[model samples]
Target: MSEEKPQRKIIHVDMDAFYASVEQLDNPELRGKPVAVGGSETRGVVSAASYEARKFGVRSALSGVLAKKYCPDLIFVRPRFDRYKEVSNKIRQIFHEFTDLVEPLSLDEAYLDVTQNKKGNPSASLIAKEIRERILAETGLTASAGISVNKFVAKIASDVNKPNGQKTIGPDEVESFLEQLPIKKFYGVGKVTTERMYQLGIFTGADLKAQSLEFLEKHFGKSGTYYYYAVRGIHNSEVKPERTTKSVAAEHTFNENLSSEIYMQEQLQAIAEQLAKRLKRYELAGKTVTLKIKYSDFTLQTRSKTLPYFISDKGLILETATELLYQERMKDSVRLLGISLSNLNNEERKTVVVQLRFEF
Candidate 1:
């Protein structure tokens, strides 16, 4: 007598504050103030913030001079990214109208699975409240969700009631909701693994389910078997609708600080023409071509080259990022410049897992 192996719904969807709420939804006098999309309160950073600039703690990689000293009426807005990818393709066409098993993860989060959908809905919390009310009635924007039973507790319950709101755990409340969560709200625990799980005292998920999977693989060696089956709710990762584009980049960050290499090959020819217009808008091509360097005391360097073919031109990515920016030299006074492309021709699309059974 052995059965039980079907429990997967998943959800995640997240947006709210996506590029400062799409610059306050296409500027209506930046609605209720405090916006901030990119940066320039005298330099760069802050790639998004709003919820009235996160109430004075203005986040998202902060520092447009400390987010104008933490919201001196912060209002910087300049990152349309093609109007946030045309409202992230109309909220991914309203999440494929219920589920093609989406998985996006950026342009503003995603990870649906719906455990058998196409609107014969069986409540993944009312299909994440009708996909956050049809992404606020077709992109006036405002989304947040997190139903569960996988994709790591629906990506930490889509940040428990953030901006808009949503949160479902069910399946008998996913093991006491991951045992009272908070190992820095786990979902790939960061900030250096939440200070190495608070120096091993593991601060919750019931202190990492009282250790030992051989003491968390002797202290997280393979993420200690993913915090031992994610606090025993046991995740079986899925919801992957073809996501593969390993690398294609472009960078600049230089409002001053280039101690000439003919101004770093004229800023690597405008970052290899914005990485060849993002590898010709994803018709992608690559065979390695990295060359990132940021100095002015913020020390960092990289130089790479690997090609026998694949290259998305812009004069061959500025002649291999100007031969790795003169194959390296001035280690000081640089301030950032980048270009990247990496062994890609974009293939790798074969993930089809469909296990059905649902109950919320």
Candidate 2:
């Protein structure tokens, strides 16, 4: 008989309204008020929204104009990335205290593998609670956590009881917890994918599990296999300590739409300069340069060109972006301009796996 693999304990931790919460934590008067981090009422997009603003449908990626329309009293604060980074570093330090097996998804969230940990704690739920308490105490911030046997379930569980809360799906409960979950709640299933699943009559994990691997692959391609395994609580991806930077980009939203190629070229020049500076800071270069254009009506389009060799110079980026700008006729008045570099020079870091003895 084959030996059954031991269940792994994973935890996903996410800060509550990280950017907006940081704003509130810094400014005592902003507490309990609707706040948005980034963007202006006249132009730009909201990077994050406080829970109060969320009540009015204010959310990240929402246009500032619509955000203000949703909450007339919404207060817009410029994003202070440095401050947010400072807080993020503190939270990461706290995670390292428990386990070195941590994978940060963003500045506000991460996945931790504590099946074997520095604290020698057997109860992942208790460890999650303690880590949250430490975050609250150290950063004056509230965090939510999900504890489960794998990253997929842990990530989903983190959102179950959000904003200073946590939930754990133990090994014995993993299958049923996933079976009853809404299909949309699966981590990688976005709006388009959810709609596709809905059309295929896959509304819940149970429905997904009912489909054959061949059927799922036929519909979702490689992702079909993911769905087949995920619903069975079979995610094997580990919590990687080092996440790769897939791309680097810089973008600007104009206060007014630009109709002239000359004006657009000028904006791309500035964006290219910013992108180059960022790439230089990281000591990275890329062979692919992509131009992102957003029209006044919010229709998005992208143009990309691959070079013979990697380049991070502003002049080269600007030249390529300029070519792309004039490559196509104006679809509509351009409202946003961006430059991005991909196929980066950063080397892929390999992960080392370790065997652990599970106590739970």
Candidate 3:
């Protein structure tokens, strides 16, 4: 009798030691040597270290001093985020070749649904292999990929054979894989949760599966539901492409509270200048400018002004802020002053897209 296979196909691709690997790709001399990319001081930490460095007990986020202690001859390099971003865009373009449903976890990691892909490749494992080969060919860097029927198992599979390796966990293998998984390896389980799990004698996936849902909920509160479903290899959350800015605020606490209008105006101008810079950075223009004032007595008040058109200009922001500040009737010095711009633009259109997430 022929058995039917499940129809879901998911792939999780993670660049192995992404930042460090990118550094090695750019400079041929740094390959196969202990390389750490981040700061170069006692106060700094390693953001990423090469596999060679990892051999000497060095890792990302470790203090430079500790890393040096492990490998005295370790080389530390500064991170060039701009260059990293350029390479990331290149990698993303490569992903679009396989599937448009790519959900980037960060600059280095992403999930792709290749069940009905643009490439017309029916095998998810083959797509993952091709993607890895493409990434190495295009960027001269190595990446690890996991192929599975769902995102959860695929993410775990990617880490199983890391650093220039690929893994696949089919529907039939997920049960055994789950039984052997450490509870700490489960997504969303942090250091504190892992410690709590250990205290509760929940050391592995087997232990977690043995616990009652009510016990998980009682211990973890609202997030208990997540723990329960994770053991069963289920995650219903979709990858969200559009991220909304709830609010944009520019605030500066005064070194000293100001009673004089002249000083307050000076402060507002500086804040508006900062606000303008941020808006331009995000490629957004705001229609409403709100002023926040905290008086010496700790009482707070706010006033807002809406414009006919979206703007990110410094002069316009300062003018609007000054007018709103003037309207606030305050008899005391202000300890804090802030300017917020909201009612964001959508698709470069003048029409405002108010976040339904926001309540008036």
Could you say which candidate leads in lDDT? Answer: 2
Q: Which prediction has the highest TM-score against the true structure?
A: 2
Q: Can you tell me which runs of candidate 3 are displaced by over 4 Å?
A: 1-7, 241-360
lDDT of 2 at 328: 80
lDDT of candidate 3 vs native? 0.82
TM-score of each: 0.35, 0.87, 0.71
Q: Write the per-residue lDDT of candidate 2 for residues 176-292, one digit (tens) a residue.
A: 998999999998999999999999999999999999999999999999988888888888888899888999999998978999999999888889998998897667999999999
Ranked by TM-score, the better of candidates 2 and 3 is 2
* Reference-based lDDT, each prediction: 0.84, 0.92, 0.82
Instruction: Judge candidate 2 against the unseen true structure and give its global Cα lDDT, from 0 to 1.
Output: 0.92
Please list the residue runs of candidate 1 whose C-alpha ends up more than 4 Å from where it truly belongs after superposition: 1-12, 18-40, 54-71, 75-102, 115-121, 124-162, 166-242, 253-261, 266-286, 290-319, 324-338, 344-349, 353-360
TM-score (C-alpha, index-matched) for candidate 1 = 0.35
Tens digit per residue, CA lDDT, model 3, 48-127: 99999999999987888899889888889998776887888899999998877777877899888776678877778888
**How would you encode candidate 1's per-residue C-alpha lDDT over 92-163 as one tens digit per residue?**
988999889898968889898988989998888888888889889887788888888788888898899997
Could you tell which candidate, 1 or 3, scores higher by lDDT?
1
- CA RMSD per model (angstroms): 21.0, 3.5, 8.9
